[model samples]
Target: MAQIQASIEIDAPIDKVWSIVSDLDSEPKFWKGTKEVRNISKEGNTITREVTIAFKDSKCMQTVTLYPKEKIQIQFTKGVIEGTKALTLAQTGSKTRLDVIWDMKLTGMMGMFTGMIKKHIQSGSEQALESIKQEAQR
Candidate 1:
């Protein structure tokens, strides 16, 4: 069990950020790794999705449960990385703060490279937050 926590300040009001963040299907608009997101089903505030992330020779399937703009919990039901990720947002002053907490374990042979996995994920997460900030500010 490894954990990575990070946050970024977006230059936008909370509502403006929420509007973009709450629309789960818009991830490809800001995230490069994400190729597409399709909502499989929704019940009330929770949504289940089939997420596709582009990689060499593969298309990863991530089953995710999203709680609107408050949080998103993900499990990679089909991929080399299998674990959980929770992303949340909060308001700070007049800006929006996005925070990410990732708890993950690598699948199969990849499990042997725990340190590398965390570092890689942390780096990717930081980049993703930066992209989110840019998209929200636009």
Candidate 2:
């Protein structure tokens, strides 16, 4: 198993940051690699959503369970990352810090390039957090 964690400080109140980060469906727009997100169903904080991820000549499907305003965790119940968890919006000195914890088991060719893959994904996460900050602050 491999793990990658990334964090960013957003210049905004926690609540405001939470409002944007908690919205699971809007993640694709902010996270470039995400192609689509469709809520399959929802029961309170647990929501099952189908996520499409863009890649070279292919796409991957991932089922994500979200704890809005707090966390968004994903796993390939059926692609790349066996599991992924993103913890959002921790308040600190008037700013919101967003953190992501990704745990995965890479297979085939993907396994050989774990370091590069992790960096790319972490960068995307950082970009997403930046987008959230801009949206919330505006």
Candidate 3:
């Protein structure tokens, strides 16, 4: 599986950071790779949704579990990708540290290009975190 991780420290409180990250519907605003999101179902803090990604404009089903201000776990259950993407928050002094980790691999014939796409995913993740930090700090 290809693994990518990126993190940013926001000059804001944990709650402030969480407020921005927890809004799943607004993901496309910060995460450029995520073109769109459509909710399929929700139960408590967990939600099943279909996401249109920038990679060939492919659609993927993901199970997202929100852990309040601590973490958000996204499990890719269908489509081109298979694995997990986790967002974790840590408080340092008065600031919040947001970390994004993508542990995934492309499925089927696309699997061979996993290594080739790793850098693109990593760059997108870093850009997303930076965008999140900017929004939260504002």
Candidate 4:
């Protein structure tokens, strides 16, 4: 599996940061790789959704579980990618540290391009975190 991680410290409280990150539908605004999201089902804190990623406009099925103000776990259940992506939050005084980790591998023949894809995902994760920090600090 290929692993990628990104983190940012926002000048805001944990709740303030959580409020922004927990809004799954607004992900595309900050996450450039995620072009669109369509909810397939929701049960309490768990949501199964279809996410259209920028790579080849491919649609992936993700099971997302929100852990209040602490973390958000996303499991890629279907599509070209397979694995988990987690967003975790930590509170330090008045600042909140947000971290995103992706542990995944491309499926089938796409597995050969794992290195290239890893770079793209890593860059995208960093960009997304920066965007989130800007919104949370505002």
* RMSD (CA, Å), each prediction: 2.4, 2.3, 0.6, 0.6
Q: Score residue 40 of candidate 2 by CA lDDT.
A: 79
- Which digits, one per residue and each the tens of the lDDT, describe model 2 over residues 13-39? 877887777777788878887888777
Model 4 reaches what TM-score against the true structure?
A: 0.98
Q: How accurate locally is residue 43 in candidate 2, as Cα lDDT from 0 to 100?
A: 74
Q: Once superposed on the true structure, which residue ranges of model 2 sit more than 4 Å away at CA?
A: 57-65
What is the C-alpha RMSD, rounded to one decimal, of candidate 4?
0.6
Candidate lDDT (C-alpha), each: 0.75, 0.71, 0.95, 0.95
| Pick by lDDT: 2 or 3, better one | 3
Q: Per-residue error at 10 for model 4, in Å? A: 0.7
Better of 1 and 4 by TM-score: 4
Q: Which regions of candidate 1 are displaced past 4 Å?
A: 55-63
Instruction: Give a tens-digit lDDT track for model 3, residues 49-134.
Output: 99999999999999999999999999999999999999999999999999999999999999998998889899999999999988
On a 0 to 1 TM-score scale, where does candidate 2 land against the true structure? 0.81
Candidate ranking (lDDT, best to worst): 4, 3, 1, 2
Tell me the lDDT of model 4 at 130: 94
Using all chains and alpha carbons, the TM-scores for the candidates as numbered come to 0.80, 0.81, 0.98, 0.98
